[model samples]
Target chain A: MAILTGVSMQNRRPLTGWGRTNATVAEVIEVPNHEVAAAVKEAGPRGALVRGLGRSYGDAAQNAGGLVLRLLGSAHQAVLDPSLATVTVPAGVNLDELLRVLVPRGFFVPVTPGTRFVTIGGAIASDIHGKNHHVEGSFGNHVRALTLLLADGSTVVIGPQQQPELFWATIGGMGLTGVILDATVGLLPIETSRMSVDTTRIPDLDALFSAMSDGDDDFRYSVAWIDPQAKGRHLGRSVLGRGDHARLDQLGPKELLSPLAYGPKQLASVPPLVPPMGVINHATVAAFNEVWYRKAPLHREGELKGIAGFFHPLDMVSRWNRVYGSSGMVQYQFVVPFGEEEAMRTVIERLSVSGAASFLAVLKRFGAGNDSPLSFPAPGWTLALDVPGSARGLADLLHGLDRLVLDAGGRHYFAKDGRTTAAAIRQGYPRLEEWKAVRDSVDPEHVWQSDLSRRLGLTD
Target chain B: MDNALGEPQTILLLGGTSDIGLAIVREVLSPGARTVVLACRNVEKGELAAAGLRHGGLAVHVVHFNGSDTASHEQVIADVVAQHGDIDLAILAFAQLGDGAVTSKDVQAASEIAHVNFTGTVSATIAVANRMRGQGHGAIVMLSSVAGERVRAANPVYGGTKAGIDGFAQGLGDALAADGVHMMVVRPGFVHSAMTQGLKAAPFSTTPEQVAAVTAKGLRAGRRTVWAPGILRYVFSALRHVPGPVWRRLPLG
Candidate 1:
């Protein structure tokens, strides 16, 4: 008599989600397009979990016996208001789709991550940054408004001008603030997809920092490829690169066909599920590191690289995470203020001595701090690494790194972190208590929640 | 957590052979939920879906459950609880449907429908609810429908049965409110399932996938009710407000 609408008595199998972290739920809900608000209300707050593209490096998207709101296909794109240089987009709209339409219109996002595949909501929640954080700041800085569905099923519009407290609290509060349904974001003008390029191989950490300090003002985007294998004086050897939009004059007569059309054929290979204990060993990574470091030109030079090639090299392989196998992997990124740059050195030293191998090691100098309380960037030195999540002793190693990062007055990026302890998270996120106070006032019943919320003890 | 590093999820499907039910199980249970307990009468068909879900990485087992076998219902519940420690989630999704003409011709058909629909639910709920209530918490989703709101001659038998279940779940929800025991009654309009194979798309007809998605959300939110094509909540609200005389004259079934 109880009408079970879609219960497949024949196929009455309970389905789940993509993020492989937790699997405690008995059932899953795939709401119709644009129904996150009503669905949240109907789901009625047993500590719900909101999921984006399932691309988070860790358990931020996982939950146990809790409600998971998968927003990607549930919400679609909204109309753009060109006059205001702004667009009203659903929280589910991925960045790639947004940029494809915006890039040709002479405007672009001020900050974007390595892959434009992330959702706008995920971007703000994570407050992701690109190589240009040295100039533009994190994605939250470009957001103008956020429409949130609170725990009690009430909706509120928060932004810098409206509900400023909730705005700051939710900016990087993860999904703990509420389900982000839509938002208005300011866009930057861009002439083309091409980046007028430059490259320089700095021999040592000192030279690397000095180059960034002196030349960062000259480029719109900047980052350094660090060699973690290098020891002693050459510990942080790197290749520095800086660029801006390519001007029409910079193109040769033959290249003038579409001077700014800079998307190149992205060609990269991702292995099928990594063989148990597969290729990312110290010997393999050491060899790869040697070749990469040697390939950097010894002298400074300017070279033209397509935007996608330069910014999103990882996007080439569609499901590259499989390369790390079923255990998955973590992208460890942390920022220590300039005064505590030594912390970066200590981390590198620890990784080197432990023989922990990482494929991608990047170093960047962050610029001014944004007003969003939990924003990750500051006037500091940031280092990011892609280390295997299942690496033996990874938990203890990461715990040690957290201690050093805290002692250095720094914090880990929640967006990319999966294993941080609640105490360590509190120490890393200085503004968390302030954000929690705001969340407590709005979601007094404490309904809005996610896997990250439970992991960090941000909710009951 | 239902899964370890690479293990699949453990699922308990109450009514094992429902086609739309299985499709939802396939769509959402993919690559996770390793152990699946299919409680059904035909152990063979149950084994088939179990194998299918297993091929997708889930380990499935078949147990016996007859909705009309009220006396055995308690034992079935006890056996499942004994075997699985505490059921992570028990999908209470069993029901009976009959062609309107046959149901009108033979009141026996209506009685059979009620046997599986209302009486069966009450009997099974008594055992399952006790177990869940005693366990301190778990989610129990009963499949309900929009037709349950008002019975019409077109399918009065099926509709009346659903009406009883819908009301029972509401009351059961209130009773279990404090025990951390939850129930989600899904009210989907006409669905394009095997049960309605040749039926044309009604104004609100939806797919099994859509129903599963909404149900998943309802389960996650710990909601008491889930409506597929969610606008049905307001639409039904308006229907309730229509005067009895006008409602009776309406041609729509």
Candidate 2:
């Protein structure tokens, strides 16, 4: 076996999550093939962690002063098993690339996050969920098998049926167990890339919650945009949107010729230069929220919209995060169980009255969580908001929200987290010990480590 | 490589330990700027500053740079480029602010101030401009001052040096506009930094962070010049046109 060390192309660079909040320096090594096992074995005491597209909103992919293997450079083709409705793809392949190939073939990823920019490895590691999560579980549920490079420099094929303990641990393990080289994922068949969307305006928090609880099951996907600045009687007023893949008969004659064609185009791009303190302040966000709410139709149904328009509207603009400016922004996402409606209501009410400025506030109903110990979604309400990190009293506000969530039998999502505490993680995941035990057996030396694992004491 | 937030990946700080320079660096750090080269005459101080930024998870590189050493200015910029590739932004923030006594009576002090603040700035600016011009895209932020708008008799020599650099930076900005290189001249009122620790607070006095905020804002807007605290621009505009007798008697000094 050829040991490829020292002579490889490597540079010490800073790496940050999609949030662009906390950045750390690491030696990034570009792994061009499945022989990444050699690089993993040769990594120094700090060990090595794999990164794909750097889409995680936290330090999950960053390893300070250690080796970071960028697996995207590894060229591996995606093979489609047409009859089985499954596609085997390299871990480096991103969902956008996979979609380009699968969509034309009349299939779509079983699970896709808000943005298709995420790699398959990153999606599985984070166990990402989407709008359809209420109907189709997380990305981990559709994964049939994966080729993970163990800490001992040995490649192992693991699945839900084979080494289920390790498989579950690695699903939401944040790349601690091993590096995923490729995965076989089940795909969903689609008649067209367009979605039949329905939108409605809900007056208040009570109405919004009841509407989702009562009607969300009828649609395959559902989400709501809540106005955090709305107070008093208007508090939690939202524009609820529900969508499902449009059938052949649903399309007009003009769209029928190429119903299955999937092409997501960038309409505009945010300028690279960002002003200090950012452009999204309390006033701007409130104004934007109001305009967005009023502009949405009170009731609209069966509107045929492009896949990008229906899902991931923000993805149409490249570098849109720049709108937050140099201070960056924070995305707080948490899930509270079904019975904790009161707790969830209290949190939302507090945020609304606290004068906190959140640009994107989304509320979704999660159906059920998979077997992954740290999976974020549960059969309840999950609220996500993008608040400027520079906002005054943000830390205290989020800390208080964390306490509320924990008390309500809720936990924060690790993929969208940057500042959660170790004690919080412990209280959140009851099966953390079980996941760690399986991790220890596979990599007793803890060779696969990241800054996130270190911060949360997951390596110990 | 730009992060999702579009912040620069690399920055070069000419005056590594300057309060305003460090402040700007901190602001950009949040937007995912990773590599920083702190070039200063004081290696120990530069290393100390670099260490602080490193603690914040940035990759900091310290280099020996004497602002007054005009001959070595080109080499300093070349070295940084060779080591870190094209610098996304280069900050020219090295200057000497002499007191009243030195400005009026001390020839040696006045000469030293002129050499460091004006001539040195010219040297560094030219070197950075040449490299950025070759790269086809880069931003340079020059820290000018409100005192330069109209030299006050209170500190003639210090104000004179600033006046010289401010004019040069503005002209250079015009020259580089077509080359895809941008130059932003920030004119800030008295800033409460180590440089002006005991000085009386001037009208519209600001902090290094505030000045940094204005500079970042200006860079974003592609403005050729900006005023820290912003109100100072109106103040200076009206003050600049005042008769010499009236301006000298205003007690601004």
Candidate 3:
């Protein structure tokens, strides 16, 4: 096993996810290589867990009083298989790094989350789905095979055909089954790192849903930025954006020179000084929502944009989460199966009327659910919002949403969950017991654990 | 990291279970705070408080920290810094509010109060300042009281301790200003918190939430010293000039 060189070890290091909520302390060891198995074995009674770019947005990445393995320094390289359109790389390699390397080679990750900072391990662990979920299933569907380091110091190669149950469990398993070391992931071949986007401003919930249902099949990726503050007749008004990977012929003469060049730059960064109250109050969010809504073209087609511009606009501003002020923001993401549009609409109405002040509320259509029991998406409507953590009566409001989601036979995404109750989990995931059984079979000792796992009673 | 509105990503609360501390924390939580360290005398109580405040994606951690443990003040500060790097804000809201009768007559009681409210605070402030100075950026908020401005005969012992901490905090604030570390000394007038729940409501009394709001506003405005109700500033200024004989006769004592 290769030892992690230049990796620092710190005792009682405090950790939080991207959402900046539910902070916990752990002994963090930066695993530099496959030696992570040895490090896990050295963890005390609290056990050991792995953490990647820490983008789970909740306690999923945090292990309180336990040993946390940071894989940022883990020594693994991306090996591109151009012929097969697959890349076998270390799970610690983040999407941003992979994209930078792969895009020029006419290849892109099959699926990507909202941001590119997430590590491949985190993406697979959470089984992240992106705008293309309407067309492609999820990140898990693209994996060829993966090497998982299980408890009791053993490693196994698993895929759909090889150890199917454990393989599916590991996807969106929140890292409870084992540590994902490396994986061969199938990539999508693209001619350019640009998107041919179509923009439309829909007036209301009914119209937006109708438009999506009728036209979503025409595009590979589709999403809508809903104005949560919109009320009454204008309720659920959204700016719909649909796009597909741009081809070489679609580029202009200037762009055609280096069509695959990937340059995601930071335009601005939020400083590290939070004011007493955040800048994103009701008034500011309302105004921002209105401006953003108005800024979209009533109907525009064939608008070319960079991958970062279309997929991860927020990435342009590093530490943008600070905009919410010291009170961190809550990302509420729930998906109700198809034919449950009424429940989804009711939740949106509640959020709007409650004055939750979420400027980044989005609605997207999920194509279908995968075998991963805990995977967040299904063939349904998914709405995600960033609510200020300090909002008064937020917990009650979210709990209410959770109840609605559960009743609709929907579920909240564990990767973005912070305050979900155990009862909600039981109601949301009908196959949770099966997933738990598979997990227990692999790690009966419960070596892999996190604050989220403990909170949701996933670990006994 | 501070957001567009200048909200800190991390906060350190010395009196983790204190109502005032929690209120200030909640106020900060609205903007985009990421990590919170609740250091209190009772870890269990801190944990309970943490659970209540845990929402959104905020991460809350509780550690055993007794304000009266002057000998361990440095270690506590070190441990906090070591665990959580570059604490954006460190709130020294821990203090002992002894009974007026017991504090006035009992040497041990008065010593305990003085030790926790003044000596302990002083030691902790020094340790925090040193760490902040090294980090080159941090803020420290000390919870002082109006009683410190003009020590009244009613609770002279408690007032004396507050007075000592008030002066020490101000001096420390001035010293830290040069090091890019801000020190905010909050002079609230009889805050209605768990500590003062049973006591008579003093003039210009405020709630922990009100104090927290004012403290947050003060932090944003970059004010070194702030009075909770704002009116208390003028009231205290006028009362400070009152003749000692006349002050003693006032019913406030």
Q: Best candidate, TM-score-wise? A: 3
List ranges where model 2 is wrong by over 4 Å: A1-10, A73-76, B1-253
Residues A375-440 of candidate 3 have per-residue lDDT tens digits of: 878889999999888787786688788878988889989988876765678778888899999999
lDDT, model 2, position A200: 100
Provide DockQ values for all models, in the order shown. Answer: 0.04, 0.03, 0.06
lDDT of 3 by residue, B107-139 (tens): 988888888888888888888888766544567
Instruction: Show where candidate 1 strays beyond 4 Å.
Output: A1-27, A72-76, A260-272, B1-253
Model 3 docking grade: incorrect
* TM-score winner, 2 or 3: 3
* TM-score for each model: 0.63, 0.67, 0.72
Report per-prediction Cα RMSD to one decimal. 18.3, 9.3, 7.8
Ranking by DockQ: 3, 1, 2
Top DockQ hit: 3
